[model samples]
Target: MSKPVYLGKLTLFWCSSCKVPVLDGKCACGQKTEKMTITPPGDIRPAFPYDVNRINEVSRKQFGADMIRPDEIVLYNKAPYEDRMEEIICGGVILGTIRFETEKTEWVLMPRIEGARRICNTKTFTPEKMKSGELKNLIVLNDDAVPYVAEGTSVLVPGIYDVSDNISAEDEVIIITKKGEVVAAGRAKMSSEEMRNEPRGKAAKLRWKGTPADETSPEYRDDAESGFFSAPRTWDDVIAANRNILDTFERRSIDFIRNTAGNMDKRVTCSYSGGKDSLVTLCLTNKALDDFDILFSDTGLEFDETLENVRKVAEIYGKPFRTTSAGNAFWEGWEINGPPSVDNRWCNKMCKLTPITALIEDNYAENGCLTFIGQRKYESLARAKSERVWRSQAVPNQIGAAPIQDWTALHVWLYIFREKLPYNPLYEKGFDRIGCWLCPAASLADFMNLRITHPAYMAGLDEKLRPYAEDKGNPEEWIRYGFWRFGKLPPFMQHIAEAKGIITGNPAADAPAEKTGE
Candidate 1:
């Protein structure tokens, strides 16, 4: 006879896909399904309820309230008695209360969220001066009761009697008995059904938490290299350095005007991409030099919204904006060679550099003119090498002045705040950098957020990229794996939904994956 299956307290019930808990008897997947609602076993300790307002305050303190929703709250709850572990059964928008001890000041549990397995402790989980011995005594693992687990072993496929409905591709989860005892901590290797069918390979990547509630930092990289660090310890230093940079820029600007102001004819132009840096450069130049031209080269792949923003800003400044379309030539080049990758960056050089060079050649003057740019030293390692004043080797006898070279991100934000400058709305929404929509340099989360926030933009990207990925092969994997599976919806979308008390039906609509053709 087959071994008796372990059915802990977790009850499987058919529910409406709309609300995973309210028994609707049918799932949107068209298959009958059952979900496990996490409930603690007898006398299981519970996390105390956290105030929603306190969460908002903490979020504001961590990440300013400039763009954050004022109503959003993030509360903390602790897993009840050390013996039983917490499991996140469902993943999506959820609202539930938790119970905890009132006297415990050091530990607060996050709101009871389905699929929000405790990934890491963020300062509040541990007791003051808590030790490992104290923690081991507090919690218990119901591994033996699960029957799917063996001591000193990895989580294999056959032992997984049941899987959580909300398992994501790379989400962290708790392995436990349906009775709510912690077995192991691990990352999900496959989705629920996939794990059941594919009875091979690893299922959950296991982890060991030595302390019951140790508030240790999560294992992740520093925010600086990841382009996620909006503020750093050296921000003040960077800000102080900006004074010298601004002075250098002002002096160079005057010199460029004095020398090239008369010589500048049709050839001299500010290359405008409608980016914050480029816009600042063109506006400054337009103010300083009369009849200076704004050169905008369209590569055919810019976002429609971005293009509109460009036009709106240009119209506002009342500057003469000249446009050069380079799509046909770029497509021709792609047909011959191939799509550009991050390492190649040939698309930028070929499509942008070639057209601008052609424009300069067509309008070359006897006296070489200057190109004022809003290039900043803090943009990347490449820009770090740039100076306040330097002559471009690409354009002989033409000088480039990067007035904002030494500015920090805070300075940029401050400048925009103080002057009420027009900027790409994308920046306000948390996109650190903006360029081609399909660029691979974008993080998976970034791509996911873009798709969820801007479905129309994603649709356009899909139409443009489908033929290309198909031509190269493994189109499905490219779409499913590279695009959808690992991608994440932007955090703000959920925040917005939470604030409005509405659920986002199509969270990944704006994803580049959705935009790209499979």
Candidate 2:
């Protein structure tokens, strides 16, 4: 499994007077604020294509139709040192998040109020809103049931006061007290009528309970602050704010490169992956050394945008681009070894490492090259603990060093923006990392977006997995859920499949045949 990317705890404060997220206890417009936590149904996943459509669909299905406005801008925010999780901000508040879970699935977790707004909030199934089909999923509790229905406690059927007419089992719901306070958010265990009439059984499973933050008391409005929601407007402003830090990083990286290369007798090269990190590395290497070549491993699975970007960067820098082809190696390996999984990454060996090794040997075998790669500690635990310089056993006579190992993703973006560098266009299109187009390590959201932007690629992938799935007695859901990408289902996925009564086939039988030609 890939290393877990840490997501920092997110907190949002509401300025009731300004009706906007405020950066400090006092807003720019000068309004007192109170803390408010909007908890979503699941962990936040990465934003995918047609996000508005998906949000609308969930609203209409779970609450009511025509709830969220089309003009609401979705802002993706990342915390310091955290790259795996992205918070989804709308209307100056973090209403939801896209989180990459341990199972490698990205889920969008939206708060109850956010869900209500998306579905047209009716203020807890009010008689008037009921006629207009608002508050479609709600659980009303009697006065006596409020305290017992705390976070993590299941709501019982007996103390039910009233409920929305359209509620269904497993529907996301806001649980309200008899006095009209939205005390908790949960999933309904039974339909509306069942929850109202049943004498015994759980009615709803509470996800979060009301806290002091949720209290309507007037005295608690002076101690809250919103962080990034009220950040500066322009990219230049952001760069300017961090200019000192950027300069420090730039100086340190340049020195590291100079010192490392000055002691080595071998040729110097930058392992250009065409991603933001590699691009930044290339810039720093140029500043440190006058003569260095570019080594690009064309895995054949690279995005068309990335291939073009490699050429563009090489041309601008006037460096000799040494390309090593992995032509059809990924497909050939997949055919012989089954689809590559996090556990079995033969595809990387075959398509990336093998070709790059040969390229080094064929060109610079006389003297090994010192390669600068764009790797950051924030990327993973393995990379976090890695040395500034090291030699890999997989490749002979080559030393690797990372200059920007301590920088964050935010720092990289700031530098790139300040320099006005032409980055890969895919990042603007919502791709976080650019690598093999069909990399199994990719999140489900990536594949979902790929399906929209590149249907033929998804079709080709499904075509390859269908036969393998069918032979193993696995249902089409195995392929649909991207389970085929993993040799063994991780704990989270296994639990999910079990809950849904989906059976995953035995992995031993699905193992591929012997290796083919290298």
Candidate 3:
């Protein structure tokens, strides 16, 4: 059984003219925009150089060349998957998904029709080139099979007119027409030689189909090259495109902050998390307030970059900075809890909330403080429905307010660029969200990333968790595949783990708890 997917606000619009996402229906270039309906909980972000290079390398593995060009602006929207799956968007269309597979331990690109069309250009690239080993993974389908494959039918051995040698059973392949228009992507059921010699059977199983949702394929009917959707777009262009809207939003947020804080006669402070959202909140707080304090939670797991950003932000603003200590609380709890899972996050409260709440109480003893924190609605379902100003049951006496509640990820990034704020540098390094280096909520993709950037840090964490994992399941597999994240193992996960004998005993029980933040 599979879980139902929750789609958040479908208000994301893209401007083809400027090749950038816009907050409004109209673009600064005076072009009408198209709606980009992406995966749920749409906290989309820009694909920085690190991320783009990763995508290009993955594309090169499956397809012969790079599908993305330097001039284009790409967006990444995280989808609900066991490890990691990011829907990649460019030129106002969701070109495909880039997923991290645990068994393979590599990034794979599952291109949409638009994405396939981008690479399978008949002009510069041809079937002759593939046979000569200059290019690879090409499968030319007979004309009769083209309509069937386009209609979502598997390609049979008899349907294959030509095939490339690089393909083996279960390898990702591009199914194209005799004239070279890509209609579907598939996993080879047999090797290229088997497809050529075998009498009959499925040559490839259709994985993803195209074209009831995108443009009509008349242009590619004659085997022409794709436009590649390449257009130069800098962050400056995005800022300029949304200039009017950014100014409007800044003014509104500042006003809301001033009015909301004025109504409350309590001690004031802005929550600084050293992440992008909090950085933007701090900037807004400075504009709205005459005098306010800055509060930071020094959760022992924080990264060196985060700690540095927190200090720099305080020093730059010349505000009274206060840090609270959790003081070995996480380690003490983890000793009993083992490893916290997505379903059971007891570490959040023990490591962060207790210390933060205690700090708030000690400072504002009489009346609780009104803390302006960075909370965006697009980040999750609970936040989308949450009030702009509210009280946290966990934290006594502190009235919480979100100044950037309605802002999207793009809005935050563009604002950061406009203000020239000294934000954390990790965003450019391919990290979507920054906080604890070993956050339990993080996926295997996030963990694997540490191998290159923080091998020592990951080694230290693996040493601690390996002992705990050996007691519950296959030690190495458990940690490697991120099975420790599932207290109540998801059905799909259980099937995979059980087949491999990774989970030899009962799965861990889920002890539910609310997640404050990363």
Give the whole-model CA lDDT for all candidates, comma-separated.
0.44, 0.66, 0.80
Q: Candidate 3: minimum summed lDDT over ten consecutive residues — where?
A: 508-517
Error of 3 at 422 (Å): 1.7
For model 3, name the residue pairs that clash: none
Q: Which portions of model 2 miss their true places by more than 4 Å?
A: 1-108, 112-127, 140-154, 158-161, 176-181, 211-237, 492-518
lDDT of 2 by residue, 1-518 (tens): 34434422232444455444432344434455665443321122223345546555655655565333543334345432111445555554555444434333434344444333333322333645644555566666777777777544688888777788877786677776644455667778898888867788988887667531332334322212221123224444435544555787799999999999999998999999889999999999998889999999999899889999999999999887898889998887666677776556667778888899999998899988999999987665588778889997889978999998877666677688777777998876667789999887776667877887788989999998888778767777777667755667777668766754556633433454345222
The TM-score measured for candidate 3 stands at 0.90
Better of 2 and 3 by TM-score: 3
Each prediction's Cα RMSD?
Answer: 20.1, 6.4, 3.6
Q: Which lDDT tens digits does candidate 3 get at residues 197-246? A: 99999988887876422223675442232345546678888888888778
Best candidate, lDDT: 3
**Tens digit per residue, CA lDDT, model 1, 236-288:** 22223233333444466545554654554524567678677776666556656
Displacement of residue 279 (Cα, Å) in model 1 is 2.1
Q: Give, for candidate 2, the lowest lDDT window spanning 10 residues.
A: 220-229
Backbone clashes under 3 angstroms, per model = 24, 7, 0
Question: Candidate 2, overall lDDT?
Answer: 0.66
